[model samples]
Target: MNRYKHRAYNEELMDDLTAGGPSMDQTLRELETINRWLGGNFVTIDGLVKLLKKSPSRPLVIADLGCGGGDILKLVARWASKKKLEVELVGFDANPHIIEYAKENCKEFKNIRFEVQDIFSEEFKQREFDIILCTLFTHHFTEKQLTGIFRQFKSQAKIGVVINDLHRHPLAYHSIKLLVNLFSKSEMVKNDGPLSVLRAFKRKELVQLMNDAEIDRFTLQWMWAFRWQLVF
Candidate 1:
C-alpha cells in the first residue's frame, strides 16, 4: 500500500468506540511517547503560535477537537504559562471513555477542560472558539467528511484552525509499522500505527479539501518525520 495511491479506508482498531480499559490506556500513553519522540507535538504548537502572534493580547479560547488523552493541551498549558497568555482550553473527544481518561491525564491544568462532543453534532456546531485545533485527527475521516468538518471549523474558529496530521508517505507507513511492532505492546497501536499513514493526506488532497471548504487564507508546511502543519 503506497501513500501516493488513494487513501486506505481500512479502519484503525482504536476507531472502535468499545475500545477502552488497560489496552486503551496503554495505547494512549504510548501514543503520547510516540508523538513526543517524533517531534509531532511541535507542529501543532507552531501553528498555534502563528495565530497567537496575530493577537497577543486579549484572553482567548482554544478548542482541541478529537483530543485523545489531552496530551497536546498539556503542552499548550505550558506554552501559555511561559508566554503569560490568558487562554482557556477545552478538549473534545467522541469517545466518552477517552474523555474520562483525558480528564485525569490533564487534571493539573486548571484552565483546561474536556467534553464528549461528536464533531458532526449540532451542539458542536453551535459552539465557537478563538482557535480550533485538530492534531493527527483529520485522517480518521474521509475526504467528504473532512470537507464538511473544515467548513464547520472556518465558522467556529474566530482566529483560525490548526491542523497537524500525517503526510501519507510509504516511509511513514513502514517506519511506524516497524517502530510500533518493535516497541509497542498495545494491539491497538500495533494495528493503528501503519493504518493511520495509509489513511493520511497528501498535499494536493489537502489543498482540494481546503478549496472545497472555501478556505482561502491558509499556510501549509511539511514538517520533520512526514508531518503536515496546516493553519487556516
Candidate 2:
C-alpha cells in the first residue's frame, strides 16, 4: 500500500480498536512502558533544555501538542524543574476526556496547564510558544496533513518545534507487539500498539516529509529502538 493509504488504514483500525475506551490507568501504564522502552531519551526535552541553558536571559514557554493525558508534559515539567529553568507549559489535546484527566492527575505541577484545543485550529495564538513539542504523535497524518501541521507549528512557534515519533519497521512492529503483550492486558493496547508501529514514519521518510513541508533548518536525530526527533 502507498504511505497515505496505509496511514488511513492504520487510523481507522486504531479508532475501531480503541473505541471501547481504554481506562486512564491502562493508557498511562502503556505510555510509561513506551517511555521506558524509549529510555527517556526524548530529544525534544533534551534539545529544549540545551536551548534554555544556552540562553539564560529568557524564560521558556513550551506547548506540548497532542499531549494526551499529560504524561509527557509531566516529564517535561519535571525536567524543567530539575534544570531550575522557568518554564510555562501548555498541554493541548483534541481529546477533552484526556484533557480533564491531565488537569486532575497533574494538578500538583503549578506551572503546567491543560487545554482542550485542536492543534490545527486557529484558536491558539500564533508565534506565542518558544518551543512546540510533539511526542508519540504525527503518524496519524499523511504528507499533506503533516505539511499543514508544520505550517501551523511554524506560525505558532517563535524559536522552534520538536517532533518525536516512532519509526516504522518490521522489527519495531514485532517489538511493540511483544512489549504490549508482556506489559498490558488491554486489548486496545495489544491491537493498537503494533498497528501504530506499522503506521509510524521511517527516518528518511520523516526527513523527506520535513523537506516537503519546507522545514529545512532542523536537526534530525534517533534514539533507542524506534524514536526519531526533528528539532528546529
Candidate 3:
C-alpha cells in the first residue's frame, strides 16, 4: 500500500455534498448515532482532562478540529463548567453545513465558537491556540496529508496537539460493524462505520506519522478497544 497516498476527503466530495444532491440531514443524523455508539466523546474528554491535570498551566484556548456536530465541544464545555476552568473553544471543519449544525447545537455554550476551516489551506492561522485537538478525524488523511496537518498543528499550538482517532484491528472492525447495525439503522452509520475502522491507524503507524511530521515532544497511546491518543 502507498502509505503516503492522499486518502483524505477530496474537494470533489466536499463540493458534491455542498451542492445539495444528497440528504445532508440524514447524513448528519447517522453520524451522530454512530458517534454515540462509538462512545468517542466520553473517551476523548475523559482522556483530555486526565492529561490536563498533569500540566501546570490551564489551557485558555482549545481548537477542536473536525468538530462535526459539536457534540464533543458540548461535552468539553460541560466539563469545563463543572471544573470552573474558563476556556475558549474554537470548532473548525471544512463543511459549512456541518459547522452551521455545530453552531446551532452548541448555541447554549457561549464559550464555544464554530467556523469553517480547511486544515490543508494556508488560510489557517498558526501558534494561536494553547491546544489543538483532532478527534476521530485523522483517518481521513494519508501519511503525507497527516504530515502537513501535524506541521500546521505544531505551528499553531503552544502546549501541544491531541489526536484522538480510530485504531485498525480485525476484532475492532467486526465489533463496530455489528454494533452499528445493532444500535443504529442510519444508512450513513452503516456505511461509514466499517470504512472508518478499515481506514484507522495502528499504534506504530500513528507514532511514525508523528515522527514524520517532526512532532517529537509528544506521547501516543491507545484505548477504548480502538481509540488512539497523541498528547504532548
Candidate 4:
C-alpha cells in the first residue's frame, strides 16, 4: 500500500444502516470501545478544555457533528457534570437509526439530545453552535468536501471547532489491523477500521486543507495512538 497517496473513500457499512439491527449496534458499540481505549475521547476533551478556559460561560452549547453512538458527547456530559458547568450537548447525524441508538445510549444525560440532519444541508448551515466537534468523523470525506466543511465550521462555530481524527501512517495502519483482527467480531469493524486509517490524513495534507479552506487560526497536534487534535 502506498502511504504517500490519499486513498479513495470507502463507505463504512455502519453508515448505511437504516434500522437498529444487532450487527449494526454491535459495530457502533465496538467503535465506542476502540475510541475510549485508544485515546480518541481524550484528544477532543483536551481541545474542549482549552475552549472552556478561554470562554467561561454558563450553558455552553456544543454540537458533535457526525456523532456515532454519542459516546464522546456523553463523556463530555459527564465531565461537565463533574465540573458543575451547565452545557447543552447536541448530536447531529444523517442516519435516523443511528440517531436513535445514540439517543438510547445517552438518555440518562438530559443535557444531551440527538438530531437527524445532514451536515451539508441548509438547516445545518443556518444553525449556530458554540463549539463544533468532529471526532473520528472527518476522514470519510474527500479533500474538497473537507475544505468546505472546515469553511462551514469556521463560519458557524461561535467559539471554535475541535477535530479529533486519524493520522494515516504505516505503523498506525498495521497496528490497528492486528488489533481489529484479534478483538473485533463485527465484519463492519474488521473491514472499516483499517480502511479508515487509509482514508485518514497526513500532517502536511491537513495543513494544506486548512489553507485551502482559508482557515488559519488553528492548532494541529499529533496525539497518542495515532490521532490528530485540531483545535480552531
Number of the top candidate by TM-score?
1
lDDT (tens digit, per residue) of candidate 4 on 94-138? 988888889899989899999999999987899999899999899
User: Deviation in angstroms for 167 in model 3?
Assistant: 0.9
- Per-candidate TM-scores read 0.97, 0.88, 0.85, 0.96
lDDT by residue (133-160, candidate 2, tens digit) is 8887788777888888887777778888
In model 3, the runs with Cα more than 4 Å from the true position are: 1-22, 54-59
Count of clashing pairs, candidate 4: 0
Model 4 misses residue 171 by how many Å? 1.1
| lDDT values for all models | 0.92, 0.74, 0.73, 0.88
Compared with the true structure, model 1 gives a TM-score of: 0.97
Candidate 4, superposed: residue stretches over 4 Å from native: 17-20
Candidate 1 lDDT tens digits, 113-165: 99988889998899999999999999999999999999988889999999999
List the candidate 2 regions with Cα displacement exceeding 4 Å.
1-8, 12-24, 125-127
The 10-residue segment of model 1 with minimum total lDDT is 1-10
**Least well predicted 10-residue stretch by lDDT in candidate 4:** 12-21
By TM-score rank, best first, the candidates go 1, 4, 2, 3
